[model samples]
Target: MSRQGRPQDTRKVSGELFSLTYGALVAQLVRDYEKDEEVNQQLDKMGYNIGVRLIEDFFARSQQGRCHDFAQAADVLTKVGFKMFLGVVPTVANWSAKGDEFSLILDQNPLVDFVELPETHQGLLYSNIICGVIRGALEMVQLEVKVWFVQDQLRGSDSTEIRVKFLKKLEDAVPAGED
Candidate 1:
């Protein structure tokens, strides 16, 4: 199920398919790297590229028919995106009336469960892919945004926060043919 008044893509791609896709990606990376050192660097680089392409489809596939209003957009982002991607829809709270600032509260994180960070990477963030996704997606809408994860006290150290700051909003100009 999706947001009310929203168009849905009901095509279900199974977990196996995703695994195959990821496997293929890693295989390609290994071939391209020709060495272990390059493979690690390329994996993170691939995450950025994945983030870029995912954002394009995320908007068109999820938000295309829904309300373009900021509040509604935030709702869809939290409710729909969380369920499909992470299997947990986060609680949306502390919304600014001006619609400029908001917080994403993740009660359950699929990425962090049973995960421990190494000493060299204690500040190691798991969902950096999402950060890149937000950056790429907002850039497309002409809204330059900075997105980062924050740890809130209430949920203890395991909690995750995605803070989005709108640097600019898109101003769509009318086309001549439309007039």
Candidate 2:
């Protein structure tokens, strides 16, 4: 009979494998797109799709409950979400006067650990997918936000920073066939 004591734990992969695979993917995208802006947009789009689905999994696995405000969401994103998924927890800082914007600081980025952006891809945002992911996740919860990477160590920045701006809350719209 199968072991029935404790349930199977979550799957984990080596950081090296993850870093290499992700770096290769980005490199290929850059080669195919042939333009920094195009590559960045494509990466963001892909990340948005991932984020849309990832939010559901995050809700189920994390069991953190609903976030009532931006602060709570920020906490969950930096503390629980990043820590669990990436094994690296980002710090949330640089709050705006109106509390509509903040910066998520990554002291260490696994995605860029072995990544080096060539001179040709100078303007390209290598980690743009992260911004898209954050935007997608927040949007899924009705918090329309703008997320973009402002600093990237791959491009010679000391630390990576993602700027998140709270645009506006989305209103639930009824489906056409519902009523």
Candidate 3:
């Protein structure tokens, strides 16, 4: 049983199965959307929804507490979060002098294990969902952040890099009647 008193599936998921499933979803989205930008937005939205829920599971499974700062948050996300979910630990690099921003260099993106972006879909961010996931997860922790794909292997980049910028921490809201 999991910490939440739920049964956990210990079965390991095949990487190929995961990749093919994601590919099919992207393909369907491309067919449904008229523009690549729209597809990217849709994918991000999907990831956001997933992230919102996934964070709860992450905490339950990992037994981690709140992050004290953006730098720590980035470290935990790359070291623990990515490893838990995607089976990859991205290298955190390219920090801004202000320490408000950094980049995650993914050596291998499992989501793109068997993906090849067609020439017509150059503008499409095939892994934009990752950005959304990071943004959504951070938001849940009261950390407002901006995430984007700076470079993509599918887009001919030598490596996959996701850039994250910390915006601000969200303040707790008072109840309407108590304020």
Clashes of each: 0, 0, 0
Which 10-residue window of candidate 2 scores lowest in summed lDDT? 170-179
lDDT by residue for model 3 (1-179), tens: 34587566676687889999999999999999999999999988888877777888899989998788888988899889999999899999999999999999999889998788999999999999998888877778878889899999899999999999989888983222210
Which candidate has the highest lDDT of all? 3
Would you list the clashing residue pairs of candidate 2?
none
TM-score of each candidate structure, all chains considered together? 0.60, 0.89, 0.90
What are the C-alpha RMSDs, in order, of all predicted structures?
Answer: 8.8, 5.5, 6.3
Candidate 1 versus the native: TM-score? 0.60
Q: What lDDT score is found at residue 119 in candidate 3?
A: 92
Residue pairs with colliding backbones in model 3 are: none
Backbone steric clashes in candidate 1, count? 0
lDDT tens digits by residue: candidate 2, 23-90: 89988997798789999999898888888878888988989887888888899999998997898999
Return the lDDT, model 3, position 117. 90
lDDT of 3 at 8: 65
What's the best-to-worst order under lDDT? 3, 2, 1
Task: Say which prediction, candidate 1 or candidate 2, comes out ahead on TM-score.
Answer: 2
